[model samples]
Target: MSDRTQEMEEQVAYLHKTVEELSDVIAKQDMELRALTQRVDLLIRREADRQSEAPGAAIFGDERPPHY
Candidate 1:
């Protein structure tokens, strides 16, 4: 094959490998994001439940200033 053709083929191969690697990274990140989202949702629900259980208990149990 001509040098130009060989160079093109190599570039294509490199690009294919890069794309596969990026795809794998993206898939892993997507899974991690989903897990994190679920965790956050669970935490939010728990916090809401706690707040509802105790009306006077602030979010972090910090009382408002007297001035309000």
Candidate 2:
């Protein structure tokens, strides 16, 4: 094979390896993100329930506002 063809083949191999590694990382990140999203949803529902149950409930375990 010509030098140019050999160089192109090497580049293609490297790119394929990189792509596979990136795919694995992305899949792991997607799973973690899904778990985090579910946790956030649960927290939101819990907070909403708390608010509905008691309107004057302390938002941050106390009556002071954020500005205080």
Top candidate on lDDT is 1
Prediction 1 global C-alpha lDDT: 0.90
TM-scores, one per candidate: 0.82, 0.73
Q: For model 2, what is the alpha-carbon lDDT of residue 18?
A: 100
Which residues of candidate 1, in runs, are more than 4 Å off?
58-68
Q: Tens-digit lDDT track for model 1 on 1-68?
A: 89999999999999999999999999999999999999999998897788889967667535676787
Candidate 2 ranges beyond 4 A from true positions = 55-68
- The residue-by-residue lDDT of candidate 2 on 1-68, one tens digit each, is 99999999999999999999999999999999999999999998898778768967656634577686
Best by TM-score: 1
Candidate 1 clash pair list: none
